[model samples]
Target: MAVLGAVGGLLAALGLLAFGLYCCYVRYIHAKYDHIPGAPRESFIFGHLPILWRMLRKQEFMHDLFLQWAEKYGPVVRLNAFHRVSLMIVSPEGVKEFLMSPQYSKDPLVYGRVFSIFGERFVGNGLVTVCNHEHWHRQRKIMDPAFNRNYLIGLMETFNEKAEELMTKLEEKADGKTEFSMLTMMSRVTMDIIAKVAFGLELNALSDDQMPLPRAVTVALEGVTKTRIPFIRYMPWKQKLIKEVKESVRLLRRVGKECLDQRREDIRNGKEVTLDILTQILKGDALEETRDDENILDNFVTFFVAGHETTANQLSFTVMALGQHPEILERLQAEVDDVLGAKRDIDYEDLGKLTYLSQVLKESLRLYPPVLGTVRWLEKEHVINGVRIPGNTMLVLSTYIMGRMERYFKAPLTFNPDRFSKDAPKPYYCYFPFSLGPRSCIGQVFAQMEAKVVMAKLLQRFEFQLVPGQSFKLVDAGTIRPLDGVMCKLKPRSCAGSCQA
Candidate 1:
């Protein structure tokens, strides 16, 4: 009995020592951002975690939650996730400093999530997710010419062709009664555009229902979003999910490999190739060090994924906002008619001429940016708005939150396209739908151009109204899109030459 008692006493002492060490470690982890303000912590171990998880589970607007925290804790709010800390910055000076400079690299852990999915390298070193600064520079330099004005202008035909296909599909249900998800329609059209224009393959997703590629891409993206939650990998019942995700990943990579190989063979055989992204990827292949076959396929998947979903969501948001605001809708339609007229194909110059449509698109992005924001990891400590940001800290620069803040936008909740008119002063750091600086989305011009073509055609051909009892809320599944998919009932436009909403 005495020996057992002594053993218990020693165990207690060891437990006390371990508890003391844990306290010290927790303090050390939190000391980095103790100075920054934030919502009151729930617990040191899971600072602000319970609230975030609750929000996620309830399908609440996580971006709005960020704005509320910013309002309570001031512009620079520090948030803790497990042992790591993330600082949310909304100030213009800080956004400029953090995003404009090359010194602040992307958070590899966050980006590295995109670098793979379920133990598979998915976007492997692609331009959008690659963290190596020098490697990204080499890839970007070679691909810049493809997105240049001359090249995008050449893509106008592909845009019009795919969008017209969508119009034909919409016509079947354009009887002024049937409700369809406009986002579903737009998603198909945009994916088709990416496949045809960027990849030189006809996806025909707009007209076909059984395209395995589209479903594979969707499943793969869902897998990417799942990877964000670290615990999902260990869920005992997720074996089937793991299999589907892996199959989806392998399917995309296998298809990408075939495309890459065929294109390479064509180039070698002296066969003509279109001026598309595949061509640019081949051109970049001249740099032998970066020309690994897997690397080439990484870009193939990267462009297809990034180039499709975001624009579809943005187009759907613009349509939703327009359906809500009749006056703005009328103005956009008038502008589209005046600029595009009865012309089947919209010229690149006419795109700039549709000024009101441009404003509407910008306004839509402000409220519902497809990509809410991006993250950066600063190399050293810095101060912004008089608050010290620690070195090696994860920073979230959220355009979605900033767009709705009263300080950044007047009457922030209202859907006002006039705010983005040419006469209206430009938002400096508060607006970045395509992001800002060197790391901005490479497909910006291509995306906007495609949007104009589709938006203009939709206005010219049909009048759309949102289905009743459907709430317009945002859903964040890797990217932010309308939760309800923007259901709409369409009527064939009676007055194509001069339609008024």
Candidate 2:
């Protein structure tokens, strides 16, 4: 009994020692970052994690909290969650230096979350999630052809076709009384377009409301967002959602594999394959010594999700913004009418003529960027906006936060597409909805072209008004989107010289 008592006493002493060491470690971590400005810590050990948890529970976007910090602390604000320290830097110089340079790779912790959703392989080593510069470069080089000028122009027909289908669907609901979710319609159209254009597979998401793919995409993306919540997979309440996300990912990859195998068989059979995204993906794989099928699927899922979700959200928010500001909507409609009067199909040249439409899209992105922000892992010590940031840190670059800052834009909260007018002084490194530099979104042009075609057509054919009492708040579900899905009532426009077809 005495020996056992002594052993228990020694264990108690060791426990106390460990607790002391942990306290010291937390203090050390906080001290290292104490110089940088940030919110007051609510917990010595947790380091603002409780505040973050509260925000998450409220379903508030994490960026909004960062925006509050940015407002208080200025351009370089420190963020601490447990042992992790991040610097949310929006200074133009910092944005340019970090995002433009390939040396600052993507943060492994952040991107690695999407690599596997609930321990199931998802977008593993895809271009967006890959941190290795060399590997991403090789994949990007192969994928470049799919987004080339000529290739994108070739996709114009697909864009027009898909957008027209959406118009048809909207026309049925254009009684001015039928309420519907514009986001749902836009998501469907974009999904159909990507599925058809990228893989030559017909998902028909626009026509088929019962399609499983759209739901899977949404669930999978929600999983991506939920992964940000620490220990979410281990949470008992989230287990159902966790299982759903894993299943969604599995479904997506299974579909991707089927498409990939069919494409490979076509190539083997000497079939003439067009330079679609899947072809580019397979070509990239062919160049490798041994093809990593998972990597190919990664790009497949990446393109499918990134290609559709961002553009769909952009369209929905643009619609939401235009609905709120009728005068802007009127001006946009006039521009669309002038540019595409009595025209069923929009030409590639026509996209440039709709300049106000371009401004509206840019403004919408500023206010409602679907992807929100990107994170970079800075290996070397750096000074940003007079703030000395230590090495081995995660640097968060937020377009959403910067675009809304008074320092960047006068009357920032005001919806003003004129902010992007031709004569207006261009925003220098402050406005990057598609991000900037070498690792910027490859499909920027492709996305914009598709957006213009859709928006222009929607404006030409229908007048939409926001449904009453719907929340305008944003939701961060992997991508930032309107929480209420931009519910709207639409009426077919009967203006002079309007295209009926």
Q: Using lDDT, give the best candidate's number.
A: 2
What TM-score, computed on C-alpha atoms, does each candidate reach?
0.95, 0.97
Per-residue lDDT tens digits of candidate 1, residues 1-501? 999999999999999999889878878978878989988888878888888788877888777888888777867998887678899998888789888988788899889887788988788889988888998898999899889998889999889898889989999999999999999889899999998888888878877888887778778887876675559889888778878888988888888888888888898999999878998998888776644888888899999888998999999999999999999888877887777777777788888898888888999999999998899997788889999888888999999988988998999989998898878988999899888899999999999999999999999999999998887988777788898989999998888744432
In the order shown, the candidates' Cα RMSDs to the true structure are 2.6, 1.6
> What lDDT, from 0 to 1, does candidate 1 have?
0.87
Give the CA lDDT, 0 to 100, for residue 210 in model 2: 96
Can you tell me which runs of candidate 2 are displaced by over 4 Å?
A: 1-9, 496-501
- Residue 210: error of model 2 in Å? 1.0
lDDT (Cα, tens digit) per residue for candidate 2, span 9-47: 999999999999988887787788899999988877787
Q: How many collisions between residues are there in candidate 2?
A: 0
